[model samples]
Target: MSTPKIPILMDVDTGIDDSLALIYLLASEEAEILGISCTAGNVPARQVAANNLAWLELCGRSGIEVALGAEVPLLTPLRTTEETHGPQGIGYAELPEPRAELSPRHAAQLWIDLARERPGEITGLVTGPLTNLALAVKLEPELPQLLKRIVVMGGAFNYPGNTTPSSEWNVAVDPESAKVVFDAFSGLPANRQPIICPLDVTETVVMTPEHLARLAEAADSSPIERPSSTDSHGLRSQTSNPLVRHLVDAVRFYFEFHFDHKQGYISHMHDPFAAAVALDSSLAVLRPATVDVELAGTLTRGATIADWHGLWGREANALVAVQTNPEEFFEQLIERVGAFARTIPGI
Candidate 1:
């Protein structure tokens, strides 16, 4: 019997990991990418859309709709992390100029229209802030019921914040939008709840230099180079495969950023793991909760609090992923992406 294909719509900020998540979906035979919605987070909405187009062009995949969303959060001034994801959001990996045209539709409209067109069949994967998705929910209250599921990579429940004392970066960037999305999902069926891939679970999924080498080897790419902290600050990949080369250049920056923060030469493969879970929820061990984002306290704004024990007396609005296996995830990422890269026309 053939494996079931998942029709997925991606909402991303095109961070380093978001790029990887997009590529992983492209690599997977099971993912039928319906479209992509870009929001401002890692860099900017326009840059995010550009990264999406470049990646699609690199993988020789085409005709996917790429739309730009709001440039700022619902209620706050925009903030971007060029230091973390590089100015263009793909590290040192310079991509060829994209030849495809951007979708004329807005990201919010894309979300609303696609959900209406493919209700109960499309799984939405959001790997950035919640601006676009929140707007869609506000426009169409039935959107929560329309999507088959939403896999979100935000929040930091049960984990320390990477941004503030209490908030994850994505949630910290736009807490109001996050709150809106969670509130809209209240009273939805268990299947309709968003699978929250918060920092609690996502940060534990680490990517190391060895994993990069393994991926290159799996692709049969020549000159496998495992990036290290001791390497020069501007080292770039010289592999024969264009895909592996750009990936190495991109992830090396992520590894360096983590190392500089004393987190070792490793990157938390947050978004790609969420991408995998969007297709197969079994990849994560989930626990239902009433997930809400804090928007008021001076020190607690953007913090995500989970009512794991039903203390709130309301229905659980999200399914929070509490645990996942890093080893199992990396193995599949390597095997699947490596094989897929081999099939793409190399530069």
Candidate 2:
């Protein structure tokens, strides 16, 4: 039997990992990307949208619509990670100017419209701050019921944060928005709650130098297959496809960052792992929990407080990922992405 295609809407900040997540989803036959909503996180909202478009164009999936969302947090100053993602948000990877235009509708409205159009069929994958989603929830209070599932890549849970000792970058960038989103989902039924891929789980899913070498080897060995037509739609394919090369370049920076700063050579598969789990829930071991953001603590602000033991006697609002099979995750990523690279038309 054929696998059913999952309609998905990705809200991204288009950082290095977010770009990887987009590539993974584009390559997967199971994902029917409905649209991509860009927000401010790793870079500015406009830059995020541009990166999304460039990636989609490079992947020959530019038919998908891209929209720009919140330039800053709902109630806080915008903070970006240009140092982490590099000036262009993809390290040394260079993509051609995007030929596609951003959709006129704002991302929040697009989310609401899409959810209303196909209620309970669209999986909303958020790989950025929750600003756009928080606004959507406010505009459409029934959004939780409309979306099939919401997968978020944020928070630190029980792990030390990349941003601070207690908070992750995504949540820290926009704590108020995160709080609104968490509270909105918390009031929903158990089944309608979001599935959070916090740092506690994502940090465990690492990509080593060995994995990068393998991907590079695959790209080196792949044959160049160009399309017959020279139309604008034709993709630029080559033995060293842009996707693979870009992944290598971008990840090398990430690997170096981890090595120098975190004293490790392996980069955490944070956003991509969230996308993977969103596509296949069986990839993770999730535990029900009531999660909230620390809003008022001076130093602990934006920290995600997960009630793993139900100490607060509150109902579970989100499913927190605690375990994942890294081997399986990498295997699936390589297999799907490698296959997609081989089909691209000429460099």
Q: TM-score of model 2 relative to the true fold?
A: 0.93
In model 1, how large is the Cα lDDT of residue 144?
86
Candidate 1 C-alpha lDDT tens digits along 70-187: 8999999999998999989999899999999999999999999998998899999999999999998888999988989899999998789999989999999999999999998888
- Which residue ranges in model 1 land beyond 4 Å of their true spot? none
- TM-scores vs. true structure, each candidate: 0.99, 0.93
Cα lDDT of all candidates, in order?
Answer: 0.93, 0.85
Q: Write the per-residue lDDT of candidate 2 for residues 1-347, one digit (tens) a residue.
A: 88899999999999999998998898898999999999999999999999999988888885788988999999888889988887888866778999999999999998999999999899999999999999999999998888988999999887898788899999998999999988887767666679999988888888886676566455553443322222222132243566776676677667666765755766888998999988889899999999999999989988999998889999889999999889899988878887787677647
